[model samples]
Target: MLSQPFNPLPLDELTAVFARIKDLLLTQDKVDRALEVLVQAVGDAIPGSAGAGISLFDAHGRGSSIAATALVVEQADAAQHDLGQGPCLAAWTAGTTVLIHDAATDARWPLWSEAVASLPVRSLVSTPLAAAGGPIGTLKVYASLPAAYTSATGQLLEKFAVPAATLLAHIQGPGTPRHLSGPLKGALAGRDTTNRACGMLMERDGLTAEQAFHELLRRARTSGAPLSRVCSDLVDGRA
Candidate 1:
């Protein structure tokens, strides 16, 4: 099933999810720190949130450069990636928003919810980072209270994700993201192989870059496998 959908929050009603980037303009090395600031700002603005997090998904749907406001929040996000199921990944794949109003009773992701039950994340709302290419990641908020997030909260998150995705795309260009922790380094290492596979598809099928990417996304989702693996198979002529 697709996730819940909503209109963007009005400009005047928007909050500080994208805090001032005064420090961001200074250096590229601070990109991760700036993302942390954004994540913290969103959590702070929420009334009953335990924390907030932003995750950029790689080919495997795992989070990279994940920034969370609290340790439990980080643990909960890690559980989602480790288990390969959760609101964030669901939202990203479906290109919609997911709200686990109460994780205790939410059966949509039984394994993910059960895995993080020991943590302080009783509720969660995550919105997709819908970019021009497709869903590249997600931004999520966690709360210790059941039903902590409402439609209004979901709308606010959608607003936050708009610019968050844009900022992430810009910083991921060549020569940027020199230090995005370590996950990004791994993604970068696989960039060449992915590009080669994409190029092969593009030339062989007359597909544009975006179309080639969508085809790869289709294959990855179909095989229930990582994008990296899908690309490798294609480059190795196994698919």
Candidate 2:
């Protein structure tokens, strides 16, 4: 039998949680560990989220899949790469939260609609990871049921945007010489490769890093290729 779903946090408790979340984000240490902490906290903080993922876009416009729980982010990333639709892309593009309360019935992306219906992703909330200039990428959460989030919940996630953006900027900023910091320190091993791939596309196609990365994701989806493998081939001159 299916287990009963988790209960929503009461208003008082939710307020306290947001307070704590705010305090944590204000700290340099906590900001550094934002990615890891986000995934761990999202499930408990939000009533419907089964998992979450944080994607960071580097200076060269390449995306590094940093923190992820289960396959929610991974598959969502794939869907973005594949069909070029969904809340993640919207958030990244708009530099704001993209709320899809009903994926199956939404007319936003017909291709994504059919694809996500096959998965357990009935609802989604994607908040942009921004910096001083604009959006860097997205922090996305997935739920198995539609209309799982309320306006309050969406507002809560929005409250997280400023701190989250600051954290990302600190780590990947041009002013910072350091490569990794806080929670993103040991997240992925292929970051350099992804960067190299982005650089190659920039050099060869005269595309901006962001444009190149988007193109790479587009290619990966159209050809049904894994992102790392695609980057490897680009680095090795095979693709």
Best by lDDT: 1
Per-model lDDT = 0.73, 0.65
How would you encode candidate 1's per-residue C-alpha lDDT over 1-239 as one tens digit per residue? 11344234456544333546424734544776777888876776667888998876665546653678889877888887776677886776556888888898898778988898887778789998765556777899998878778878888888788888777765654545554434444433465666677789999999865457557868998999888899999999999
lDDT of 2 by residue, 52-152 (tens): 77776543234556667868667766766456656676666445677888888988767878876788887788787655445666777788888876566
Candidate 1, after superposition: displacement of residue 12 in Å?
4.7
Report the Cα lDDT for candidate 2.
Answer: 0.65
Worst 10 residues of 2 by lDDT: 179-188
State TM-scores per candidate. 0.71, 0.59
Candidate 1 stretches greater than 4 Å from native: 1-19, 26-29, 173-175, 178-239
